[model samples]
Target chain A: MKVNAKKVLMLTKISKSYQNNLVINNFSLDFNYGDSVGIIGKNGSGKSTILKISCGLLKPDSGNVLLMGKSFDSTEDGLLIKSRMGVVLHEDMLYPQLTVFENLNFYSKILGIKNVNTKIEELSTLLNLSDYLKISVSKLSNGNKKRVSFAKSLLNDPDILFADEPESNLDDNGKEIVSKIFNDRRKRGLTNFFSTHSEIFLEKCSNQLINLKDFENA
Target chain B: MLNWFKVLSILIKKDIKIEFQTKETLVTLCLFGLLIITVFSLSTENNSLINQNFGAGILWSSVIFAGSIAMVKFFYHEEQNKTLQSLLVMPVPSELILFSKSIVFFIFLSISEIIIFLISSVLFNLNIFSLKLILGCIVFNIGYSVVGSFFGVISSKSSSKEILLTMLLIPIITPILMFIIATTNDVIRSELNSNFQTWLGLGISFDIIFLTLMSYLFGKILED
Candidate 1:
């Protein structure tokens, strides 16, 4: 395969399986900066698996994943690449015992974001999380928890964000805020890679779409 | 380098903070440890010889059992909450995650040890406060925390995690368990100078080797 140094993310012939069942078979994709890519598929169709593999959360049995011209093969390079990326998976991935502000603060510290308070405040406002900042995550509704998770992914103003079902558990207003966030990220030339069942959400946030149903038949 | 330390400290702080808020691990460890000590003490009542010979065994066994139970509770929350997954996607090195957890577990184990020892001293009339015993515990705790934290994450992936953690942890830590028991026996019997250096050296060696080996393996186990 010819290498593209400028591609923001590249997955070459990626294959993954579980217990002799192949979920993603020799799938390949190239994502560039500022491109909002949406992956749609039925349940068990490997939408989340591909996002997990691309973010280095899960490893593929075969093929290579490159982010910003760097691969996950090298530990140092993997850490560097991950530092520039953000991910929101099916789980909220927040400490339920901690308040929303504390959860965001903890993540911001790990991401090495300076001016932590200001950035958290800004995101909280954008996500309508200002009132719920001091509330424990466990006390929040699913929509609020998703908002907090969304805020966390943007804590570092990451170069790329990978989210699975970004609209799950979100209300109409919460979905609109998420749409706006993606739009703003796109305007700033940041990439978004997400999986969703919502056709309207996919259309609003994604300029490029990959239907895994096609890959399954092939 | 500085950023690495900053991140490590942050992770450690987070674990400690949550632990304090819930007191889940510490309380469970202390209660379970004390129960073991109480049973052993009651069974060996008025038998000084049995107490002299078996006090260390009772103490260290309690430590092992309690530590394992506490580790299960500790990592269960990390798995249930998917916080460990969150950390994996960040710039933090996987080894650092292991190291930070080991440190936090070390702290919790140490605190529980202090309490168990004090209670054991009273119930079993054993001299657990000696310099030699304390040093031995320091070595053993370091080894336990490193090995336990490593296996804790592995077992956390399973459905029968509580049993899996203990099954994986006990066999691996048998050598350290023997070392501490032997040294604690020497300390309790006032035979402090009897091959003390040799056993201490062995304990320290086990700690360093496992800490290095487990740190390397932890990163690999966490992948995919």
Candidate 2:
């Protein structure tokens, strides 16, 4: 028996306010499968909240979030939807106590991906993290840590990837490697919603960039 | 319910690997442990009844505080270095992250408590290696870490987080520690038989209650 599940994330009039501080004011967005979009917004515009809410991190006071045609319910049934999506927020979400290999091993265990070695090897080579696998993530540079975070986002081979500044603060070579990894991911039918402050990258890889600069292009 | 053990194991293995490297936390923990032991030794004379009564209490208090000194830095280390994003991105429940952190802290507490047990016994010239007391301490330490971890996560974003963690944590943990002290007395002085088990039960219940609640609330705090 074959199971077919449609992947569409819909936010209908999502409004969130934290103690008289309004973050998101009646924002609505839709992401059907095969859509790679970037929301270009300054800090504290609720871009991260939007992604986290969809990922079940925050429950909007008044809104309806639907994942894959299912209500974004807090019930146990929604675990499947959450498991299929990957997210990297602006917050440092990686545990520093874990080494590069241990961190990758953790995702392998979390995702229940059998035979994790091949991808681990591939990601290490592609990201040039091979020498640093045994080193703690805390011992690495910010750029290298970001690379590990990138590799972790792909651990589950997630259908949807919500990345907040995925490739932030990297040199030219790092940017190229990040772009390459993203381009490879794009070919795999990976649905991604990205937010970044790097304008050069925004101009480079944003297939569907939404911003105040060019509504016409959007 | 999720597979919390997977969270627990991954956290332990990963933390142990890192902990072995610099031994930063363990070293500071031992220094703090030694300081507290020395304070107890200087404050009162050996063979004093007060020393015997306060021995287990001081042992655990020092161990818990010392363990928290480093373990409380667990999430903050991740926060500062920006590696926490990788863990948070996994498609697992956010509470698992907090749970895993707490369990690692609990393991550190247990290890420190073992060290305290050895050192205090030597310092006070008394043997505290009884099976019941050790078991009680284990349960008590686990409960303390579960509750302590929530505060640890809460303080990660605060301005004076260490003070905040201690302020909120100590009051809540006082009763748990009381139970532990009472149980230790029961085991050492041989006053009551299975009555000490009540504290163990209470400790386990506290562990379950706080672990579950914190596991749920971690997502909220972790959110922007």
Instruction: Give DockQ for candidates 1 onward, in order.
Output: 0.73, 0.40
Relative to the true structure, candidate 2 reaches a TM of: 0.84
| Model 1 alpha-carbon drift over 4 Å, by segment | A1-4
lDDT (10s digit) by residue, model 1, range A23-124: 999999998898999999999999999999999999999999988898988998888887888999989999998899989999988888889999999999
Give me the runs in candidate 2 sitting further than 4 Å from their true place.
A1-7, A42-44, A75-78, A89-92, A95-98, A131-136, A197-200, A212-218, B1-4, B82-85, B187-224
Error of 2 at A17 (Å): 3.1
Worst 10 residues of 2 chain A by lDDT: A209-218
TM-score top scorer: 1
> Against the hidden reference, what TM-scores do the models get?
0.98, 0.84
Alpha-carbon deviation at B140 in model 1, angstroms: 0.2
Chain B alone: TM-score in each candidate? Answer: 0.97, 0.88
